[model samples]
Target: MELVIGIDIGGTKTKIGLVDKEGKCLEDTFFRTKEYPDIDDYLDKVVATIEELKDKFNYANILGCGIGAPNASSKNGTIENASNLLWKGTVPIIKKLNERMPMPMRIMNDASVAALGEMLFGNAKGMSDFIVITLGTGFGSGIVANGKLIDGFDGFAGELGHIDMTLGDGRITGLGVKGGLEAYVSATGLKRTIMYMQSKYLDESRFRSIAYNDLHGEDITKAAEEGDPIALKAFDYTAKILGLALANFTAFTQPEAFFLLGGLVNSGKWILDPLHTYFEEHLLEVYKGKVKLLSSGMEGKTAAISGAASLIWESHTDEY
Candidate 1:
């Protein structure tokens, strides 16, 4: 039984898993990433977890490890200046992991790993060209063109979140970019929309009683489900931006489909329906009705684990 360790590093939490070639996470656990301010302590815990998984499973062959993190670079084997992380500088991820566990390992940003996972195991399995957008704490994207992951000159490609789409007055992102796509369309973005709508529109709803800090994306989705006008309007607003941007993206690579993943995707049709409408309506005549928008085959922790583990198998393909 050949297995690989998959680690998904997030801003607040980290998901660790033992995965096989079939895209299954046999054993998994969650760890607090923010709690450890030091990278050495964090690596020690991760290495310990891997050792426990190996011993418990008793697999004949334990293959390499794959890590998906914010601002991670496969070329440099380090995570560089990630805004959401506690670490302030470039952390040598592969070097630290290799010191404890001697095995073949790979590292890439979360979105890139997710895109690779989609190509290997998710809905975009057979597609040669596609994009995966992650709408979590922030908006992120991974692009696969001609069946190869495009890592740009230094592994920082497909950063759709930072693209300028506004008049530079929109909400400031973690990286201090105003009007960035992530600040308007992510789960955090949805919350901002709800609060803004509450101020402008005097809609009498449950959200009125909830404080701005207390409100969440899920709360907005629940409100929309119950026919709350404010919540519905928020989705429309968020979707239009995402749709227009996605439509514009078609001209770049003309992907066969765009797969949506992460927390905001859980809103289901509330987000998808309007996104499709706006995307199709705004698409250029040449690209109209040719591309598709698909949901992720695996969402949440499973998607992260499977995506990270997919890197272990990524070498088998000629496409990188």
Candidate 2:
């Protein structure tokens, strides 16, 4: 069985895995992403880690490397201006990795790789058209049209998160975009909504007991599950914004479904129910009742690692 090295670089940690073709991670490990201030040093550590894993598993005949990172470009094999990472400017990740490894390496933004993983080994199997929306600390999306991932001109397409949902004068995103979809729908967005609701409702809001810095999405979710009015309202408002944005996305690509992935989906019915309701309400008549909203078939570290591995398989089959 052929194996691939999969790397998922996040704001805080980097997960490396040895993944097989079946979307199974045979071995995995991690390191703090923030700890490496220099790109070369980071790559060196990654290579060393992979080598250690290889020796431990006695793995041989490695296919290649597949990486998912923020602001990564599949076309250029580079991560450009990734605000989350400690590195500045464009980092030629593929080039850097290839220098140390014998096999080829490919790179793409995290969301796109997740979509590929779904297409190859998850719920999206046999589906030619779909969208994967990741609702975590931030919002991310991957669009698959005609059975191909749309990388766009700069390989930065499928940025559904940055869509201007508010029209104008809305919550500012970390990207400095005002009223961006991520500003209202992501985990960070949920916390912001909770904070806003606390201010508006004052003593009437249950969130009044929580400190601004201590409040988290999990807290809001817990409260919503328990029937807290403010928490429920926050989820409703977030779903409304996300659903409308999804509705707009449907009009453009008309995907068969939208798979919601990541931590926010754990809120379960609290988010999905309102999201489905608002999505249908906002969708165009021609698109209404056609597109399906569903949760991701894959999750956790394995899902991301599998997605990264799938990129290697995809490259071999010309399916990427």
Candidate 3:
């Protein structure tokens, strides 16, 4: 069976996997991304891990490697100014990896690869246009239009998270941006919204029992599940903001659907219902009720691995 290596680089951890063309992950493992402050050291460890996997699998049909990372650029094959990562400045990841392994390798933003995976192996299999929104620690987005990923001029176009909403009282994002969609709709944003609701409702809020530092998105989710008014309100507020943003996004791309991925999406109806409601309410008449709001069919390591592998598959087939 033809195989490829998929590497997903995140803020805290990096997951590496051997994936087949069928989207099956044969073997997978991870390492702490922050542990290796030196890029070369990290690359060395990655190379060693790949070699270990190759030996264990005893497979020689490996096609190439595809990496998905924050601030990754397909045009440059580099990770540039990634705020969440420990690396400083632009790192030529493809070049460094090729020096050791000497095979075809490609890289792009994590969300973009996820979108590609969705198109090839998940919910978007037959769709020609769609958007994937990753609601992780931070918000990330990938846009596919007319069966093509929109990389824009700098290969960094689908930054829907940074779309300014002009929400004057919005929470600040890790990038220190205020009023960005990520500041109000991501996991961190959920926590912030919960805290705000706790402050607003005070004694009447169950969240009052939870300390500020101890509060988490999971806590709010649990609370919402248990019918906590404050928690539900937090979800409502977050969805309203997100819906508005997505509605505006629709005006631009008019995709057939929008797929939600990541932890916050686990809240299910607590977020989706309100999001759908407000999205339609805010959408332009021509676009209303046409765009579908869907959950990602891919999840966990499978999604990441499949996405990375799909990158290589697409590259090999000259699909992008």
Candidate 4:
């Protein structure tokens, strides 16, 4: 019964869990990330938590530790330039944690970890190539090409959000392009689309009553599920762009499948229909019937933690 500590570090909270090689979590803890202002204090708390859990579980050997943080580098074991974290620069996370646990450590960006998790234990198990796109605050993707996670030369590969898409002279945001996939597919981006429609197409329409910022992807989904014209159109608009982007990716990598995850994807049919429709519509002729776009079998917080756990398994197995 070999076990490892897995941590999923988000902007607001960090989820720590003890997972066996079988992908089952034996124990878990949640803590507010803001509780500690300094990085050292943060690491200390994490170390103490692992110690407490190891002692209580009576595990003799903690095989390894794995962490999933936004913008983490798997090859370097460092977190670099995270948009949502308090850190301003590269931080050596592996070194700090190794001091406490004295075990092998692995780290990856949250999205990459999620993709890896899927490959190891979920939908992508036994598959060699696929992409996992998390539709949340932003669109994050982890790419696996040819049975291995593509780390690129600098270890910062698979930034699918920045893929360029035609915007037709829309208002520009800080992402610096006229329109990127992230501009239309992420949670924030979807809200922006809602605002655009309110001011453009829905000025005197009933949809205007819904507050722009307060409106969520789920709200739009519910309305769509009930056959609201406005919500249906919104899904169509967003899904079309996502489909096109996915088609472009398919033409290049030709992955066996594309795994969709995160809260926004919970829209179920409201999203999947249009997404699949457009993806197939725009796919290269040869890839028409080859690619599969599937919803993530794992959902919510567990998806990311599962990914972190897979990192531990991969790191341990690689040594042999």
Candidate 5:
């Protein structure tokens, strides 16, 4: 059997998956990324896991290895200053991996890989043009046009989170940018929206009583699920920003649909219901009633690992 190794590198956990061409994960195991503050230590553990998986699944011929990570440069197979990671500077991931395993290696931003996964195995399958917007700790996007993922000249494209909304609302992103989409539409943004509303509305709400540091994402989700007015209003506000931004994004690629993924998406109808209404309202006449906003067909680490592995199958789509 022919298989490929897939790795999904995140801030907290790294998942190593052995997958077939059909995107089935025959086996998967993970190590804590945070435990290895030094890049070399991290890579050592990752490589060991890969070898263990290879030994356990000895019958399969592993073709290549693909990886998805933050602040990754697919063009260079290096990670450049990923804020979530403890290590500094650009790490030559491919070189290190090759020194150990010695196979074809490819890497890209995690969100971009998720988009690739969607194209190969999820709802976006057979669709040429679509966008995958992940609403997680921060906003991340993967744009597909003309049946190919867009990895620009330097492999730093598809950064939709940095789109400036020019709200002038004083909400600054971790990137130190003001009015960026991620500052208004991500999970971080949602929490900020709740806090802002808590101050402005003077409404009797659980969020108001809870300290900012003590609050949890799940708490807010539960409140919204139960129809808490403050949480609902916050969702409405956040969705409007995202909906408008998504409408504008259509002008660039004219994608047939926008597939949403990540933790914030778990809020379900609390966010999606309002998002659809606003997205339709703001879309240009030429594009109205055409672009669909839907949840991602594939979810969690499995899809992500498959997405990373799918890079090996593509002839040129975001190839390193």
Candidate 6:
């Protein structure tokens, strides 16, 4: 059967899947990324996995391959400075992968792929202009404008995480700005808030049993749902900053909606309600109620792969 391959290169592990044109994943596999010692080793292992898939399936109708990696530049097909990865500099991933597989290959940031996936087959389906925000180990934002992903002059546009939004005398520094939005809204950002709250609010019983260091965005959300005061405060803090940022973006880009993806968004109303409240509070009257913050309706990994698959499918169609 005709198929396409999609790969999501994450900080912890990598996911590979075979999918058809309609976004249905036919087969899927996951592997520990430690198989490789360096970027080159990782590429070798990836190529080897592709070869194995090809041999096992013997599928002649394979269309192309798509990859989503953090800090990836679609224009150059390189992973440039992923804060979560061990790599130090730019890695010419697409060139290396193409040399081995020799098929139509495309690469993009994981968040961008997720946004595209939603636009193509998920929550943002039928919408041409929107943004997808992935709140995980870090913050990732993707923009789709005029019906296509905006890969700026050098493929470095839509970097919403780096936007400045922090306020205070002793806030964390980002790049050069003090208290950037990322300093308050990302996984690390939220953790810092939780730590502060724990120090101020957690009593003996609460402090001794909880694992604050190991806590993730999901845990914070769950705690908030259970009426944990500390967790609710953290989400409230994050929501204020995030809502402010969204208000600012809405003024500039005027997208139809913003899709919230990743673990943090799963907190549901604990985060969303506050986010909406602040967003409305900060937004101008004209733009108020126009932009929405919605959950991603797409399958996470599958949506990314499907996005990668579109890299080839859409391009081929355009050519024909």
lDDT of each: 0.89, 0.88, 0.88, 0.80, 0.87, 0.78
lDDT tens readout by residue for model 2, 1-320: 57888999999989999887777888999999988999999999999999998986674668989999999999999999988898989998898888988688899999999999999889998889999999999999999999999999989998888888667788888889988889888888998888877767754666777786898777788888788988988999888888888999998899999999988998888999998999999999999899988767765657888898888978665433
lDDT of 6 at 242: 90
Indicate which candidate wins on lDDT: 1
Give the per-residue lDDT digits (tens) of candidate 1, residues 93-206: 899989988999999999999999888877888789999999998999999998898899988898899887877877888788998998889998999888888888998888
Per-residue lDDT tens digits for candidate 6, residues 1-320, read 77778898887888787777667676777778766659778887787776676676784588889888888899998999776677768989889888877888888888888877777667887787899898876778889888888888988887788776534433563444566667777777887888777777754333236676776677776677677778878889889989999999888778899988876776778888999999999998999888988888877656666766666666654321
- Which residues of candidate 1, in runs, are more than 4 Å off? 317-320
Give a tens-digit lDDT track for model 4, residues 15-80. Answer: 898887767777888788888768889999988877777886784567888898988888888989
Give the range where candidate 2 is weakest over 10 consecutive residues by summed lDDT. Answer: 311-320
TM-score head-to-head 4 vs 6, winner: 4
The ten-residue window of minimal lDDT in model 5 covers 311-320
Query: Native-vs-model 1 lDDT?
Result: 0.89
Clash pairs (backbone) in predicted model 2: none
lDDT for 208 in candidate 4 is 75
lDDT of 1 at 172: 84
Q: Is candidate 2 or candidate 5 better by lDDT?
A: 2
For the record, the alpha-carbon RMSD of candidate 6 to the native fold, in angstroms, is 2.6
Quote each prediction's TM-score.
0.95, 0.96, 0.95, 0.93, 0.96, 0.90
The predicted structure with the larger TM-score, 2 or 4, is 2
Q: Supply candidate 6's per-residue lDDT for 202.
A: 51
Clashes of each: 0, 0, 0, 0, 0, 1
Candidate 3 per-residue C-alpha lDDT over 193-282 given as tens digits, one digit per residue, 9 for 90 to 100 = 877887687536678777768888778888889889989899999999999988999989899999999988988889998988999999
What pairs collide in candidate 1? none
Give the C-alpha miss distance for residue 107 in model 4, angstroms: 0.6
